[model samples]
Target: MTTIVPPKERECERCGRTDTWNDDTGTWAVVERDGDRLSGDPFCLHEWDINGAYNPLEEGA
Candidate 1:
Protein backbone atom coordinates (compact mmCIF):
# COMPACT_ATOMS: atom_id res chain seq x y z
CA MET A 1 0.00 0.00 0.00
CA THR A 2 1.10 3.52 -0.77
CA THR A 3 0.59 6.48 1.50
CA ILE A 4 0.37 10.08 0.44
CA VAL A 5 1.60 12.81 2.69
CA PRO A 6 0.45 16.43 2.70
CA PRO A 7 2.85 19.29 2.28
CA LYS A 8 4.11 20.97 5.37
CA GLU A 9 2.94 24.44 6.40
CA ARG A 10 5.20 27.46 5.78
CA GLU A 11 5.57 30.50 7.97
CA CYS A 12 7.30 33.79 7.35
CA GLU A 13 10.36 34.32 9.48
CA ARG A 14 9.83 38.05 9.63
CA CYS A 15 6.13 38.41 10.51
CA GLY A 16 5.03 34.91 11.49
CA ARG A 17 2.54 34.73 8.59
CA THR A 18 1.48 31.22 7.67
CA ASP A 19 0.63 29.55 4.32
CA THR A 20 -0.12 26.14 3.03
CA TRP A 21 0.47 24.47 -0.29
CA ASN A 22 -2.69 23.95 -2.34
CA ASP A 23 -2.30 20.92 -4.53
CA ASP A 24 -5.49 21.78 -6.42
CA THR A 25 -4.30 25.26 -7.28
CA GLY A 26 -0.62 24.37 -7.46
CA THR A 27 0.23 27.39 -5.40
CA TRP A 28 0.58 28.59 -1.83
CA ALA A 29 -2.34 30.24 -0.09
CA VAL A 30 -2.17 32.41 2.98
CA VAL A 31 -3.94 30.82 5.92
CA GLU A 32 -3.01 33.19 8.71
CA ARG A 33 -1.72 36.74 8.96
CA ASP A 34 0.45 37.58 11.93
CA GLY A 35 0.68 41.35 11.62
CA ASP A 36 -0.02 44.45 9.59
CA ARG A 37 2.83 43.85 7.20
CA LEU A 38 1.60 40.50 6.02
CA SER A 39 -2.04 41.53 6.29
CA GLY A 40 -1.64 44.71 4.28
CA ASP A 41 -1.57 45.18 0.53
CA PRO A 42 0.53 42.86 -1.60
CA PHE A 43 -0.09 39.96 0.77
CA CYS A 44 3.19 38.17 0.08
CA LEU A 45 6.09 40.50 -0.37
CA HIS A 46 8.64 38.56 1.66
CA GLU A 47 11.65 37.02 -0.03
CA TRP A 48 11.24 33.27 -0.35
CA ASP A 49 14.97 32.57 -0.80
CA ILE A 50 15.62 33.75 2.72
CA ASN A 51 12.54 31.87 4.00
CA GLY A 52 14.18 28.54 3.04
CA ALA A 53 12.51 25.37 1.74
CA TYR A 54 8.99 24.61 2.94
CA ASN A 55 8.02 21.39 1.22
CA PRO A 56 9.66 18.18 0.04
CA LEU A 57 8.45 15.85 -2.69
CA GLU A 58 9.81 12.59 -4.05
CA GLU A 59 10.85 12.33 -7.66
CA GLY A 60 8.73 10.14 -9.88
CA ALA A 61 10.25 6.93 -11.19
Candidate 2:
Protein backbone atom coordinates (compact mmCIF):
# COMPACT_ATOMS: atom_id res chain seq x y z
CA MET A 1 0.00 0.00 0.00
CA THR A 2 1.08 3.52 -0.72
CA THR A 3 -0.14 6.87 0.41
CA ILE A 4 0.83 10.47 -0.31
CA VAL A 5 0.37 13.43 1.95
CA PRO A 6 1.44 16.97 1.17
CA PRO A 7 1.91 19.80 3.59
CA LYS A 8 -1.23 21.93 3.94
CA GLU A 9 0.37 25.03 5.41
CA ARG A 10 3.81 26.53 5.93
CA GLU A 11 4.98 29.47 8.05
CA CYS A 12 8.14 31.51 7.91
CA GLU A 13 10.23 30.87 10.96
CA ARG A 14 11.60 34.38 10.65
CA CYS A 15 8.55 36.62 10.25
CA GLY A 16 5.69 34.23 11.16
CA ARG A 17 3.85 34.83 7.90
CA THR A 18 1.65 31.89 6.98
CA ASP A 19 0.10 30.50 3.83
CA THR A 20 -2.53 27.87 3.22
CA TRP A 21 -2.71 25.46 0.32
CA ASN A 22 -5.50 26.13 -2.12
CA ASP A 23 -6.42 22.94 -3.95
CA ASP A 24 -8.91 24.66 -6.22
CA THR A 25 -6.33 27.14 -7.54
CA GLY A 26 -3.34 24.87 -7.05
CA THR A 27 -1.41 27.53 -5.23
CA TRP A 28 -0.43 28.69 -1.80
CA ALA A 29 -2.53 31.62 -0.70
CA VAL A 30 -1.47 34.04 1.97
CA VAL A 31 -3.49 33.73 5.15
CA GLU A 32 -4.72 36.83 6.92
CA ARG A 33 -2.70 37.93 9.88
CA ASP A 34 -4.49 39.79 12.68
CA GLY A 35 -7.41 40.61 10.33
CA ASP A 36 -5.07 42.04 7.68
CA ARG A 37 -4.11 40.13 4.54
CA LEU A 38 -0.50 40.42 3.41
CA SER A 39 1.82 38.65 1.02
CA GLY A 40 4.92 39.26 3.03
CA ASP A 41 6.85 41.71 5.18
CA PRO A 42 9.92 43.84 4.57
CA PHE A 43 12.10 41.91 6.96
CA CYS A 44 11.29 38.41 5.78
CA LEU A 45 13.33 37.13 2.83
CA HIS A 46 10.67 34.52 2.01
CA GLU A 47 13.21 31.77 1.45
CA TRP A 48 11.71 28.35 2.08
CA ASP A 49 13.58 26.33 4.66
CA ILE A 50 13.52 23.13 2.69
CA ASN A 51 16.40 21.01 3.80
CA GLY A 52 17.07 17.46 4.92
CA ALA A 53 14.22 17.83 7.38
CA TYR A 54 11.70 18.51 4.64
CA ASN A 55 10.71 16.47 1.59
CA PRO A 56 8.17 17.73 -0.88
CA LEU A 57 7.72 14.34 -2.54
CA GLU A 58 7.51 10.74 -1.39
CA GLU A 59 10.80 9.05 -0.62
CA GLY A 60 10.80 6.38 -3.33
CA ALA A 61 8.05 7.49 -5.66
- For each of the candidates, the C-alpha root-mean-square deviation to the true structure, in angstroms, is 7.6, 6.2
On a 0 to 100 scale, what is the lDDT of residue 47 in model 2?
54
lDDT of 2 at 46: 64
Against the true structure, candidate 1 reaches a TM-score of: 0.44
lDDT (Cα, tens digit) per residue for candidate 2, span 1-61: 8865667777766676777778887777788878887666757776544342554442332
Choose the strongest candidate by lDDT: 2
Error of 2 at 15 (Å): 0.7
Clash totals for all models, in order? Answer: 0, 0
Total residue pair clashes for candidate 1: 0
**Per-residue CA lDDT of candidate 1, range 1-61, in tens?**
9966555556565556666677887767777544433332355455432334334442221
CA lDDT for candidate 2: 0.65
Residue pairs clashing, model 1: none
lDDT of 1 at 47: 42
